[model samples]
Target: MHGHGYGQPVKQPPHTAWLVFLRVLFVALGILTIGFLTWAMMLRLAAVTRRSLDWGLFVAVLAADILSITLVAIEPGDEIHTTGGYVGILLLLCTLVGTIAYYLAADIRHFLLQQQAYEAQRTAPAYGYPAPAAPYGATTVPTIPTVPTAPGAPGMPSASGPHTPPPMPHARVPQPPQPPLTTPPPQRPAPARIDQVRAELDELSDYLRKQDGPEGGR
Candidate 1:
């Protein structure tokens, strides 16, 4: 070996190290993409909006990283085999779709709840009773009467003389008769079978004994 050009040293290309660096870089990028997407999906499902642009920014950054990784891998002398990168991109896409679907479902549920509340309110009874009828020859309908207490009632201010109770207010139009409350039919109790219950208890006891035996016990 010394006879041929005094044993020259072999020069290794820097491109080999660069290739290794590219591989590590792509792998890290892919892992980061997957982790970020998972976190984003969890936030979206939980309906957390404090970050405001979290969804948009997550998508943008993921897409940019994917594109950059793809371009780097495609470049000459940068032979980085990263199937993980493709998998990561797929996972990110799935997460984005899931987040959107979750939001839509939540929105629909909220809208339905609001609509039901509105309908309940619309069907609810008014706060007070209807106004009383007008007096004879009065142009306007009479206002609802305020009750004056009887003279002899406790805590009541005495009137000048013995007081007569005010006449009950009547509606101008007759109301439809209310339907009577119907009692629900009573359910008959199931007939008991002493023999059947005894048989079941016997079977359960046999199962328990078998389970407690040393050979078969857990």
Candidate 2:
């Protein structure tokens, strides 16, 4: 049957000057990121930071743009240019995937936090210490009191019904007794090495005096 195929060209979105400007800005950002990454790889710049990550995104987009430009340049005069075109498409697809992944991760984190908040709210006690009781003006529900059983009442178990033995008082764990303090054995005085030094000094002084007297007398 001669019919228009289902694979028809989709209508392109209308492009405004602002949209064009934004595209240019994005391309610029991409270029900047790529430049920074190159600088970092060359050791001309420091390690990555938030700014680096931002720039990397910009670079990725710029790479896509370069690929696109290359494809267009190669496909002059409607001639098929498969290589550059495919490369450009691949770069763009990579960028899109990265962006989507980032957003999905952020959304998942938000969802988890929200779920945690919901769980916290659901589990809060009706009346408790940690959470303050409902405000003064809030409607409060009255609790019913349990009735005490009378002794010897029909069908009522005796007070002696399986007495829960009081939990044995926590035994005072005796810490190991500290070692008894004994007077440290008196240390022997370090041998008098200085005595030999004193004797040598005395001998030298006597020798000096004898030499000085004999020379003076002469």
Candidate 3:
């Protein structure tokens, strides 16, 4: 993002040797008559943006650059007199242009996206998650698919509202039959002594006869 001049200037120490070393290394990679480094950077940019770049084109460009370099080396003379020499120069020029073009375009795209992100972050609600760690738009946010609500019961197209299950009806179960109860029979009373009863009867008869005799004599 910073490479495109579309990013805000950052405050830091005057300079760092590590940064200078990297810049020199980057220059050496391209100036040594090859765009391998550019292809590497292209891949890096793609990864940072989480977007795919022209991978096949990058490889083709690098291959062309190498072939052109080889041709130029074959004719190291100051003037090029052969057809291959001319094609080599043309291809070399094209590769250089392509390398720079891709780098700038990628850088610019990243920077623009970064600027938009910063603006979004500024306007974002306070309760939202924090932005990326890269303060200079070094990272991109990935999009996630929103989860849909669970589907309800299927209904007819002409249904007025959501389909609901009917309430369960109350059921009454039959009870098992039980055995009948049994009772004991009633008992009879005991009889008195027959001889004693007979003796009493005879005594009463004798007394009655004596009273009758006394009445006749009177």
Each prediction's whole-model lDDT (CA): 0.53, 0.52, 0.62
CA RMSD of each candidate after superposition:
47.0, 35.6, 19.9
**Predicted model with the maximum TM-score:** 3
Writing each residue's lDDT as its tens digit, candidate 1 over 1-218 gives 44333323222323445544643454344356543433343344244333446556455545654564564456455443566555545555565455445544553454455556555545653234333566889896569975777667887766656556899888689789999999989976555676678889999999988878976654
- Scored against the true structure, residue 202 in model 1 reaches a CA lDDT of 100
lDDT of 2: 0.52
List pairs with backbone clashes in candidate 2.
Answer: 30-58, 30-59, 33-55, 34-59
Q: Rate residue 176 of model 1 by lDDT.
A: 97
> For each predicted model, how many residue pairs clash, with residues at least 3 apart or on different chains?
0, 4, 0
Order of models, best lDDT first: 3, 1, 2
Candidate 3 TM-score over all chains jointly? 0.38
| Candidate 3 RMSD to the real structure | 19.9
Candidate 1's displacement at residue 193, Å, is 99
In TM-score terms, candidate 1 sits at: 0.25
In model 3, the clashing pairs are: none
Sorted on TM-score, best first, the list reads 3, 2, 1
At residue 149, give the lDDT of candidate 2.
76
